[model samples]
Target chain A: QQQVKQSPQSLIVQKGGISIINCAYENTAFDYFPWYQQFPGKGPALLIAIRPDVSEKKEGRFTISFNKSAKQFSLHIMDSQPGDSATYFCAGWADSWGKLQFGAGTQVVVTP
Target chain B: DVKVTQSSRYLVKRTGEKVFLECVQDMDHENMFWYRQDPGLGLRLIYFSYDVKMKEKGDIPEGYSVSREKKERFSLILESASTNQTSMYLCASSLWAGGGGYEQYFGPGTRLTVT
Candidate 1:
């Protein structure tokens, strides 16, 4: 069973619009949440991350909104660009387990 | 900069043949992981090693085995290549932060096709 669930298997957005991907987890033990971006033929790279201690964390155009009460987190891309078109994965990690549990992933296509 | 490199970008093998996928990291990370990427299924971990000569099974480790003889190198082995095993293999390395999750750096990945 997938520990973390992601929504909208795929989505298309305009270059100047916003792109949002949501993920939910059932494990309260999960304390670290990170988002990874992967381009075609390349490996996934860390984009942004947030801990449950904070409600939100922003880095440039990417922001992570975490809801500890709801066990949900989302990535929002502001002013989406064609360069941002890639597959994004959400993952949760707990120090006790020392491993990351990843979501199914969401493919975002930003069309110019 | 942290760099992880795989032995091959693409490979093809026949049924019943043995296959080996190699990964090497330059950052001297303490942990290494192997994962397979399938459409819609995402990245499923096959195995991981926290140190040399130490390994742990992951979510999907039925058809695969891993070896980490050296600190910077990890290898995934398929004893008998099967068509169903065809997928993209990714290797990642991360530092061991005592009480928290650290970032993982990934290699380019190797796409394998078993015919």
Candidate 2:
């Protein structure tokens, strides 16, 4: 069973439009959440991360909105660009486990 | 900058052959991990090592084993290659900060094709 569940397997958006991907998890022990981005021929890299102490965290055009009680989190990309097109994955981690549980991943495409 | 390098970018092996995928990290991280990425399945952990000669099984460890003889290198071994094992294999390394989640740096994955 997948510990973290992600929605919208794939999405397309126009340039300058907003792109959003959401993920939900059932484990309450998870204290850290991160989003990873991967290009066509490369490994996934850390894009943004959030802790339960804060409701939202943003870096540049990437934002992570987290809901502690709801056990859900979402990533929003502001003013999406064609160059931003890639696969995004949401993951949850607990200090006790020392490993991340990843979602199924969402492929985002931005049309110019 | 943390650099993780995989031995091969692509490999093709026949079924029933033994396969080895090597990974090395330049950051001297204490934690190293191996994961397999497949379409729609995301990345599933196969194994990880926290220190040299010490290892732990991850979510999916079947048909795979790992060796971490040195702090910088982690090797994944397939006892006998199978067609079903064809997929992109990724290696990652992270620092062991006592209480919080540290970022993991991943190598440009090795795509394995078993025919």
Best by DockQ: 2
TM-score of candidate 1's A chain against the true A chain: 0.99
Q: What is the lDDT of residue B83 in candidate 2?
A: 98
- Per-candidate TM-scores read 0.99, 0.99
On residues A1-112, what C-alpha lDDT tens digit does candidate 1 reach at each position?
9999998899999999999999999989999999999999999999999999999999999999999999999999999999999999999999877789999999999999
Candidate 2 accuracy as TM-score:
0.99
**Candidate 1 chain A worst ten-residue window by lDDT:** A94-103
The candidates' DockQ values read 0.84, 0.87
Q: Write the per-residue lDDT of candidate 2 for residues A7-87, one digit (tens) a residue.
A: 899999999999999999988999999999999999999999999999999999999999988999999999999999999
Candidate 1 C-alpha lDDT tens digits along B2-82: 999999999999999999999999998999999999989889899999999999999999989989999999999999999
Which 10-residue window of candidate 2 chain B scores lowest in summed lDDT? B94-103
- Name the lDDT value of residue B44 in candidate 2: 99
